[model samples]
Target: MTDSNQISVDPNTRGNANLIYILYLVAIVVGITSIVGLVMAYLAKGQGDALLENHYNNQINIFWKGLLYSVVSVILIPILGLGILTGLAALVWYIVRCVKGMQALSAGQPVENPGSWLF
Candidate 1:
């Protein structure tokens, strides 16, 4: 029997949360879609169960971290001429985080450390 205190996540909510990764992927092409995804993630965060909540937190971190990396990359563009490489590394990091989150969500599991900066 399921414990009364055990939280159960809705499958539909899980699917919707998974869509955030897709939005992150799409953001590669549209650029603005990540913003939309971030907004959606923030809105839905409050409604999630433990697992979904972890996914939301991971997604939110990905967005903010990516933004911070991008800003740093831009600032370094002229001074160090390393912005291109840094930007690409940031993009790869974002993709990896999204992919990893989606994989964990698909397995009906919470990420080991949602707030972690590394994948």
Candidate 2:
């Protein structure tokens, strides 16, 4: 149900969409950026949801976990030799995953096929 006063998305009202887009871009730099997008999207429910909040959150979770594991692997690489690849791989993979998630969300879709992601 909708109310008479709610501000829905119009092609003309590109402001909020712009904000969401900027936030999504920010996510690429630090996956945690999705948090800002999520909050903004939720707060703008009356203006229609950013529709990417959940996807952003999921991506953030996966990103941070991947980052943590990558950090650990990097720290262990000197002792474990050849393990540095794992950290680099994890970082690359997560970046790809987060990018995909943000893309899907921006398209007003849920990021369903992240491929074996834990969160």
Candidate 3:
């Protein structure tokens, strides 16, 4: 009953995944948008093909891990001012993860390791 010649893809899921990545990137300045992205990722998880599902898991992990890193960085602020360097490093790490997610999504592939903390 299905067309074998046609590929099955949920465009909404793909678009939502892309939007989440963009929201995370925008959070660098806007600060609150990543929360929105996180919620979207959770809502969309397991609702798509394997590729899209992997993206959702990757995004979710990114949010939680990124938050943990940010908090650790902030807590270290008064400790020899180490937070400054740690915060910068956390920012770079967050950016790299988002970029890598976007790249995999664009390639129509699942994330190689959705649970990785490092890029």
List lDDT for all candidates, in order.
0.85, 0.57, 0.89
TM-score of 2: 0.50
Model 1 residue 28 distance off true place after TM-score fit, in angstroms: 0.8
The best candidate in terms of lDDT: 3
Worst 10 residues of 3 by lDDT: 4-13
Which regions of candidate 1 deviate over 4 angstroms? Answer: 1-12
Count of backbone collisions in candidate 2: 0
Candidate 2 off by > 4 Å: 1-50, 113-119
Candidate 3: pairs in clash: none
lDDT of 2 by residue, 1-119 (tens): 86977654442243454455466457767766656755655555454444534543454456456657768787879985756777667767765665666566556676674435542
Q: Estimate each model's TM-score.
A: 0.86, 0.50, 0.88
Candidates 1 and 2: which is better by TM-score? 1
